[model samples]
Target: MSKNLVEVRGLKKYFPLGDGNILKAVDDVSFTIREGETFGLVGESGCGKTTVGRTITRLYTATDGQILFDGKDVTHLNKKDSKALAKDMQMIFQDPYASLDPRMTVEMIISEGMKIHKMYSEEETRNRVYELLELVGLNKEHATRYPHEFSGGQRQRVGIARALAVNPRFIVCDEPISALDVSVQAQVVNLLKKLQKEKHLSYLFIAHDLSLVKYLSDRIGVMYMGSLVEVTEAEELYKNPLHPYTRALLSAIPVADPKEENERHRIVLSGEPSNPINTLAECKFYSRCPHKAECCKAGLPALREVKKGHFLACSNADALYVDNQGFL
Candidate 1:
């Protein structure tokens, strides 16, 4: 059997804005999640990171594509089949406050999924909820309280517990640490890493935090607008980024050490994001690329491999590395 827990191919999601206009939110994206690894998806806001997670969960159907889960093509399952598919896959949403139900207590929040799936009896449900609450660093007492009673970080732990309640094999961590304090962010990340190890869970971890991605991801994929421009082993991506957009994003990560910060310079990118409607077939970063060329504005470049595992989507991936004088 293939080692991949999830496989996505030619995924496309588009929205019509009326009058012959369309917004290509997620266009022609493809990736894979191995059985127990975190496949990090990083991009700026409005770049369809959230849309990818939602599309995978079938919250929004793809305009065209394939979603393979555990070797099955569950891409277009109907409501009945989809509900069954959800048993093995779950998602932890980005916004803890907004994602939680205001009227429900924490116990109801976590147990509702188990009840819908008919996974437990009423007595067993409460016990499962208690176990999950403790697993996510929350106590049994917190289960009786409303979402408003906890801090942002606590509410997110509750969300994590809810996702785990179903005992899913695959989980989409949609920026689960983004809305928390810096200290708490690491805690949440560590919790995820621990949970993955203990449960043998596979994750499609989406985030814009470069530092966190470097820490938690086995492989990293960089997205610009709605397209993946580069994907490589996490350390290799930070060390030898191939795409200009990836270079720019990596350069933007702040260094904690002053000496290291002084040694390496940051790349400064200009120009606004391209129109998602994709009126032109050019490379999306061409408008702001430091090493722009006339050829880049004509057609979209297909992803190419410079090495065994590194994939880059740029016509000028190599050209930007060296100076004009040809010195490395």
Candidate 2:
């Protein structure tokens, strides 16, 4: 196995909800991304997939935990250290339209990171900026244009170009294609994969798209209510997801084969998700778990590998119960 480029241990983040209540946005999340590989984080909305990405990139400081980059601790870096760290990691936000500064031209936007880091002279920065545009499938002429002048796909490509300006080793891709049309999503994803192979960059790709994750990722991590419920290779996750939440999530993905789509059953989760602000030291899915037992309510399950390289939180993978009888 390749050495881990980034390893997170017991990562936690919380937001105050007033009156002694706290929103546990991210709780005790842990994972590792090997160098030159993409690690996909998949889950439903508000499950802290985005938070995990942001925290990894240090956009949001952790309340408690350790984030080690290449065996060096990075939880609390001073200004200089943070700036130095920025060169090694970058982030591509969910909304392309919102991520860019409207006031700046495409050239300015792409070179902004280089300017802050004092990486290049004026001419060198300008030359490199245009080079990035072409590398991302745009033209030198487009560099003079504004962000609003481009289509959604084009904008995303620009966002990617900007992210690459600093020559980062890791990128926190926070649902980079969620805002684009179906036709454009594949193009963006393919471009990312191509770049990864060429640049040998590692990624913490955060999204809810299981099919897409399986398509692009080497390994997959499943999160539920701010906690990672399962981690395994991409094929293993699709074939034998262990946790109840992961199995249910995998079951929900629509299969392409008409026969399979028609015959396959969808796992419909009952009850509501736990509140992020509540005291949820126990299992967050306890309220909706079909196979919930006495021990499950007492405490949340810890992640343990049932098979080699296939880690899961739920103790009983073979005994998974589902209430979606007629639906499946």
> Each candidate's lDDT (Cα)?
0.87, 0.88
Model 1: per-residue Cα lDDT over 54-149, one tens digit each: 999888989999999989998899789899989899999889989999999999999999999999999999999999999999999998999999
What would the per-residue lDDT of candidate 2 be over residues 104-144, giving only the tens digit for each residue? 99999999999999999999999999899988999999998
lDDT of 1 at 116: 97
Error of 2 at 98 (Å): 0.6
Candidate 2 structure lDDT: 0.88
Where is model 2 more than 4 Å wrong at Cα? 318-328
